[model samples]
Target: MIKRILLLITLILQFSFLHAGIVILNGLTHSYTVENGKVYKGKIAIENTGSQPQSIKLFLQDFSYTADGTTHYTALHSHKRSNGDWIKFNTNLVTLKGREKTEVFYEIAIPDHVKDPGSYWSVVIVEPVEDIKPSDNKPGVNITSVIRYAIQIITNYDTEKAKPDLKFESVKVEKEDGKRTARIAIANNGNLYCKPTASLEVYNRTTGAKVGTFSSLTMGLLPSTSKTFYIDISKVPPAQYKATIIATDEDENAFALNVELEVKND
Candidate 1:
């Protein structure tokens, strides 16, 4: 009788650990539009839709851009004339009670030299760094939850110039037992033919930091054509994680998207 009771308790513990109380509420934007080579105003809304209050930390990294066929990211107190610049609007820490939400706002400016304008992209990520005590007992522990929202801006240099459009279809991320993998279908939506180069960024969910980058082979994608790529993540550490996939055309215009995943080792 004691042996059966132990087995049942173990099963219940396992099930409780597998299903925790982490929730990601919807994100809101104050404004998302581009004009005169500048993103006028932008805001982010984060909510604690779980059963308990959450202590959260927020960080805003500088914007990145490609210039003269070269890619670069903005640095603190340093501005690149050729690439682009990131303007700091605001950053803060807040405690969100259950079913409550908070807002953050910022502004960005684009240089006039960026003539080949079509679409530019960046990401705003929010993560929960505090560990929550489990309501039930389990042998194992996993505590990292992150949510990210991608920001897109469309720019036009000339009325006659071709307008750029791009899309990703059937994007998916999977983690089973302990292995992780990602797959996506990229498509070109512009009238002009383009050869695209893809860059993938992997991040650690706990620390909200970048882990590594994976670059795919350059492929010639004609208008309205799509291609698929797969990334292997078996060697990555077991944690909550995410990836950003960036595609740049020959003219140096850029488009980006973000995906989230989990790694379980039970």
Candidate 2:
């Protein structure tokens, strides 16, 4: 009963976050292909879902993440490849009435001195100034939940000259929730961003027969960042096997790692 109650609370919190009073209508990622010494214009659309008025503050920040699920946010221009200095917004704060929709305009001015063909990025954060609290007055404790959204702004210059370099760091298998999973850690070592997909091919050691082939979900990897790919291997039969793990990006850049796998199914 306690576990079920906790799960209910978790679901409610997730729903609240997804259905926030202030929402960004333009999606989370805004990507652009730009040239040096050029100016690009864009806008972010926002809408107030609740009936009451909502005040929102918009700001820029640098964001970084790793394969271990650790994330860091710092001041604008903190990252080496951040484009924070190039972006300018028309406004930083706004108040919206009930069901009011608005748009925020911004521009990116690429400097003439930029000669490198690479990808630069930054994040625009939109947060509500008001805190949402539970409405029940008889509650012993009132929980306040504050929600914010970070929209990634990416600028790619000279895509023909940019290259993708993916590094396969490690691979391992683990059992959890009555299933087997193969996890692979991959890093983006090049100047561009990549969406990498991982695959595992297993072969029986004794018979030399192909056991199975499994693939993982493709995920985006930014420059100097890493992500873990998880492939379900629960259907593979228990046996001693030889396996080849391959990580491939959209550009067909592939990295392979060979390993011996033992599936006890215990």
Candidate with maximal lDDT: 2
Score candidate 2 by TM-score against the native: 0.85
Candidate 2 local lDDT, residue 71:
84
lDDT (Cα, tens digit) per residue for candidate 2, span 1-266: 99999999999987765554888898988989999999999999999887778899999999878888888889976778999999999999989987899999999999998888889999999998984565757758655576789999899999899977888788778899998998888888899977889999999898889988999999888899888999999999887899999888887988888889877768
Q: Give the alpha carbon lDDT tens digit for every residue of 72-181 in model 1.
A: 33443342211124444477566777777777666777555555534433334455656655567666766554544433222233324654466766555566665566
Cα distance off (Å), candidate 1, residue 13: 8.9
Error of 1 at 60 (Å): 4.3
Which consecutive 10 residues in model 2 have the weakest lDDT in total? 130-139
What are the TM-scores, per candidate, against the unseen true structure? 0.41, 0.85
Pairs of residues at least 3 apart in sequence or in different chains that clash in candidate 2:
none
| Winning candidate number (TM-score) | 2
Q: What's the lDDT for candidate 2?
A: 0.88
